[model samples]
Target chain A: MKIKLSELFFVCVKIGALLLGGGYVIVPLLVSEFSEKRAWLSREEIIDFYAMGQCIPGIIAPNTIMLAGYKLRGKTGAFCALLGLTLAPFVAILLIASFVSLLLKSVVVNDIFWGVNVAVIILIILTVKEVWSVSIIDKLTMLFFLTAFFMCIFGISPAIIILLAVLLGTLRAKFLKGEAK
Target chain B: MTFLLLCFEFAKIGLFSFGGGYATLPFLYHMSEVYGWFSSNELSQMLAVSSITPGPVGLNVATFAGFKTAGILGSFCATMSIMLPSFFFVLLVSKMLKKFKDSPVLNSIMYTLRPVCAAMLAAVAFRLFLESVVKFNNFSDFVFNNVDFKAFLLFVILLIFSLKIKKDPLIYLAFGAIAGILLHFGHLFA
Candidate 1:
């Protein structure tokens, strides 16, 4: 079930074309396209990549997609995926940036965005619900979620919170292993 | 020189922007203040455009900002530079994850990180909810008065439809745009 590089690039192009809201929205979209439709990756794998993507620097969507591509093919696949993901947006922004002043002035544009913005909220809410079911399992995980959520709300940098979680998780695993032994 | 500078600056942003796309806002704002490549007003406008456009908002902003700084080539350089760090880093991590797929320590770390990531995303959604669905005139405004009923209504209707139908989000987005236009016309006539 090897996918050609060209096909991979085109599939990614289609995904990139529809990525309207932001990184978080990429989760369900990729799940559907890859896991549901193509059977290339599992739902768990996509979410795992997404979580890892957030841990790394740069935009989450590209990092997740690049990892998916790497899994599907190899380095070339990753490169193609990255290129495809950026292509539409690069051209689009270039086009829009030139005439942005005019577009900004248009009441029609404003109205459309006003509505689209609301739609994006719905999308993000859906993403949170989808991710939550898989992430929060027990009391410890629940504690992790609550602490991270509050820290984020209170304006703590996400990088610090993530680092803390990783350190805490590693130490907890070691303690549990020692207890078992 | 401008292209080189754009590459260096954007690459730094790429390396540092954790969490998600919105996380890049602070860096972009600082860049705006220092470089004056685009005014703060223009940056907000770009953010608005980036939100509704069909792409990752961070990448869109980079493209727009780069173009503003040095035209087409600047945009290319900026985009590539911004993506470069993540590209290499993810590749390295992906390789490591595969190599250490069965390590209990690694598994525990991922298990813990999942909930934290979910929490971070929830936080992002909450902030967006405030920005898009609610509008407050000032600190003292009543909650009911502060909420934008029209947008809130649209959000509720779309949320219900999305939950019930489970269609591609593009369909709902299209429906939202049409509904918005209709609402605008309806207001005009009323």
Candidate 2:
């Protein structure tokens, strides 16, 4: 179907406005909006895009939306979808950030953040647990996790660590493939 | 000049940050350390703000960091730069969707990259834990006085509640804010 750029943009804006915590949260919303509600895309296609989004760099929500947009109406569709997806949150964050300093000056705000900080720790811990279930499946992966953890603790840059993992992972996979041959 | 630098740094972050939103934390932490654009304490605050806000946590934090460094224009540059990499990457992948989907090399990279990303997040969690929940006076001293029991208690409660209920993070964060206010009043009375 030839989806209008404005229609695509507005739909994505609605998604952006509802994107509360990021990550896989966008999946159900995308399935509902694009597949179930509007019929602009299929559920399976949305899932595929989401899986692809996870593997790629950048935030998954916009990445997935952009891919869907590209599929729908090529590049312009993707751009509009991206603009729609980001515009709401961009303005919202700018507004909050502008007043953040003034808000921080208030003791109540500070105290609330104090508690919120602890809450954030809980959130991070949950994230670690969630990632752990998917990422650390065996000894080799465990070693990868440990290596990166120690490197980070020892003050190595994360960008370098990620690069090293890519090299190591690719090499290991290649060796395993050769052995299987 | 600073805008260009922001674009460069965040674009790099965009290109490299895999897995999900929190994957960007390690890079942001490193950026904070390298540039002092915002302190670690402020990073945690930004994390909190990003969490409770209406968008991707990674994007929101980038916007906050940009705003912190160079105001509105900085934020615009930072947000756009971060998304730019994804724009091209996704477009490229869309054309080669079949090949990309079945590529063993990509699978292998993700196989290891996932753990690395998780580990980085663990490292970030550890740092935030020290800053917000506990403090060690020097590295050697381990004492009860060094621990913030109030924060510790709050952490335990929130963790348990989150695990059991599994609601949106916003709910827990809202509860946290209320708890914080109440705790402050309790401290005042005490």
lDDT against the true structure, per candidate, is: 0.79, 0.87
lDDT over C-alpha atoms for residue B77 of model 2: 92
**Residues B1-190, model 2: lDDT tens digits:** 8888899999999998987787889899899989889987788899888887888888899999999999999999999999999999988999999999888888888889999988998998888888777874247676768798888898888878887887876777788889889987987899
lDDT of 1 by residue, B24-118 (tens): 66567567767888985566557666766778878888888898899899999989999999999878888888655567787787778778867
Clashing pairs in 1: none
Cα lDDT, model 2, residue B31: 92
Query: Of the candidates shown, which would achieve the greatest lDDT relative to the real structure?
Result: 2
Clash pairs of candidate 2?
none
What DockQ score does model 2 reach against the true complex?
Answer: 0.76
Top-TM-score structure, candidate number: 2
DockQ of each: 0.48, 0.76
Q: State, as a TM-score between 0 and 1, how close model 2 is to the true structure.
A: 0.95
How far out, in Å, is residue A27 in model 2? Answer: 1.6
Candidate 2 RMSD to the real structure: 1.8
Residue A174 local lDDT, model 1? 99
Candidate 2: tens digits of C-alpha lDDT, residues A1-181: 5778888889999999999865447888899889899999999999899888988899888899999999998999889988998888889989989899898898888899888778877777788898899989999899989989999988898889988999987997898799899
